[model samples]
Target: MSTWKETLFGDPFAVEGDEIDETAQSEAELLAKGNVFEQPAATRGELWGYYLYYNGDNGFTMNSYMPNILQSLAYMGGFYYDGNTTAQNCNNMPEGAVCYVPWAGGSIPVASMLLYIQAIAFSIQFVLFTTFGSLGDYGRWNKWILLSATIIGCASQIIPMVWVNNDGSQWNGMMGMMCIALISYGASLVFYAAAFPLLADNLPVVRKARFDPNVSREDYVLVAEKWRNNVSAISTTFSNVGFLIVTAVLSGASFAPWEKYDFPDGVAHILGNAPIFNYIATVFCGGFWIINAIPYFLWVPAGRGGPQLPPGENHLTIGWKNIISSLREARKLRYLFMYIIAYFIFSDAVNTLNSMIGIIQGQITSFNGTQITILNLVSAVCSIIGCLAFLWIQRWFKIRTKTNLLIIIVLTAIVPIWGSIGIGSTKFGIHNTWELWVFYVWSGIFIAPIWAWQQTMLAELVPKGKENLFFGLFGVVNKASSWIGPVVIGAITQSTSNLWEGWPFVLGLFLIAIVIIFFIDVDKAKEDIRLYLLENSDEASVNGQEKSIHSVHDTDRPVSAKDEKFV
Candidate 1:
């Protein structure tokens, strides 16, 4: 029987407690020397729990709850004369809110404050990701490093719950928590995403593909992609399910009449039900992560880590050197660079759009906890639908990855384009409360699974070797543009005091990026990477054969298994 059958499909003769015999040439072989044969490895479900909880906490606690509370807190307290007020001149800020910051002698809007905070947060995250340089992909570092980052982010969620008050003095606390959450999240996210390849590699099915002579190279390549997409879609779905779980719980609490039972004095303080629920949700998400991560740590084996480090290169310098050298090589790799530039801008626009929506949702809904939670539930549900839906569309039509992305990008742009309509008039777009429902539903379905497709995009463009080096740069570029969108949106919203004004800028960004992405030819990119590898490849780089078996992890963390052939 072909080994591809075993790698592509599970062994019918096998049972639980099985370890791949690494001394031989099976798929589960590891490059590393040590193996604890007695330890029971994770079932696929156990492996999945990592994505479920980590992503849930990161997406909900950091992106959804954190920003919502920060903006609302600033709204409850942020105010001034020259910036915005209910006097209805500069824009639409409520009356009597305590002003937080004096911006050029005028107070900035809560929305602008949140946007600026987002800008700062991403900037800080870029630095952290740059500094770390995918060190999590090497041996022994991935598990500990990923857990540390997760713990830090989860720990910060507690700050908002216990410390924040609407007395206007709590802005510093919120800002501090924001920094911790954002930086930890950036590191943890790239770290988390880096685990996918290890999981796919360790799968009995994927492992067998390596030694199967019956399978043609082209067939194996196609199967490899199909297999990867399946796993990634599952991971993305789990993330959404985590989002769904968090929002559903919040919605249940919001709709319940819990306000009647509260007896504590000075608890709600200056803030109301919405921010309080958000704080609770944040803590809940943290707990959810802790509970889910326990299984991953206990059951997931840390595989043989990344290749041995280069001589004389430390973590910081190594990643920088990799990026710099890659850039030097980029002059010859046209399509890859082209895709990177487009992906960079497109990712930034998407991120800014998310923050912009959150702030704007708070604006129109008056920060009503019930409506917000309900909307969150809608988005979470729709995000799942989007992931499954897009995956189905891709599989059913057999559409190329680029085509799927193009379709998704065009559909996603409709949101900002529609919002731009609000800049001119209040009839349609996101101006009305009803429109908020549409926005969430639309974003959940079209925008949620974009990152999965994006991963596939980079994989297609990268040469056979140098996956880590180039992917680190890809991760950097994906997030590096974050500083641009939020700052631009913040300035616009700050100047106009109308959140709608920023939508135009976001729309232009989305449209322009989509255009660039449309023109990128993946076929041409494949050719470029192929020719580049033939000419420029060196012994320092892992060759193509080893590349197929290379275990990808930020450092072979949660998804890693102790199989030698995998690396």
Candidate 2:
């Protein structure tokens, strides 16, 4: 019958019941270790931690926004309409005026080329992320990856200024553009993989509010119930704002429209391309990296202590060794492996579907550039609302209720995929294009939480000592599976699907993937970090506070004679 406010301050899980002796428990259980994890009465950062976290999140969020912008342009240019031909359906264009005049006479295969561009980019990204994930584990400057990604993103967008033709087929220009994209995606993966391990390093298990050895099991469960609440706050207050900004850009007035160019609206414009948007992104990216770089160099403390390796290990050897070691460690955690499997299946599907949304709009309707952009803006706003709604739902359900929630999310995701089947077919007097937007909003709402929750759950599953290595392997799964989604749908659409039937097949697979979500163990996830913290903190106290915040190893544990000397 206790209110949430009272529950927050008073331990409802008190083991000694109503007469719980906090002092005696402190003495017997080696507790007053609370002081070991003390915060200052107040600090400038504490007052501003929320703001700082927003900045960090915004930095990463801005980093993610680059891909959406590039993809938005690509989808509209390559898939929705032509990037190469005469300007059409607009007030400013001459009747037969051509776009990208340089490539006007050349025969260009646009769709295949774009696919190749994406495939090659993703391949490079996979390799870079694998390497960066390893580096992040062993305590390299992970934040630098974000800087690299931002620079590459800006450079990629800007490269079109020199290379693209007004006609759609700037073969050389496209190749150069693809190369820049490769570098950007590669760097972005590195940034993404590197950022993940920070949670393990910076946030302690007790601070996570999921575990305390001095408390009883019921109280621990009570604390675990708040895990989703914290993440929900993080997602809504930080993550949604980024989604809003990016979506706004995509849905606003078109930066490069097909009407100003020469050919059919869907053709490629290889030359005489407008570069204003690219310049804006480049400037923003430069600012983003410059601002974020200062914090990495100044404020953030290095927890792993300047990256020590056992004698013969440096970047090359250590990097390869780290990958192999991470893979080996991953094999040991069955729970993590299962989650990785489920995540890959679900996330890859989500990515591919999101990537092609603009194209879907273009194929079904004669919507103009501004409308396309605005629709995307609407989608972004809707997505933020969807993400926030999901988090609110999660908060409503106690942490232990995750098992049921996962069942519902996974099950609900299937409906959009199923609904997408008739999306372009037009069943109820509505054009397929309008229905496609509805389906897009529907799927986005259901699936937005899956990404953040999966990461949070993975963080829980990771053991204390192996957080970096485990998450590194998690990155491997993420990148490796990324290509599969795009390749599958792209291939299906290219080979078998007519203008009518292709999207439904892709939707079916999305529906099929939902069944696997039921197999995952949310109960284990809820208790995992709590269990890890309780175990580690107790051992640290028992050993007379010998534990460094970074490293907590037991000195008294018996080791084989041969291995003992290494420690």
Best by lDDT: 1
Candidate 1 lDDT tens digits, 321-410 = 767887776657887788878888888888788878877777676556667777777876776678789999899989999999888888
In model 1, what lDDT does residue 469 have? 59
TM-scores, all models, native as reference: 0.79, 0.61
RMSD of each: 6.9, 11.2
Q: Please state the error at residue 257 of candidate 2 in Å.
A: 14
lDDT of 2 by residue, 119-167 (tens): 5566666776554444543445555655566556545545554432333
User: How displaced is residue 464 in candidate 2, in Å?
Assistant: 4.7
Worst 10 residues of 2 by lDDT: 558-567
How many clashing pairs in candidate 2? 38
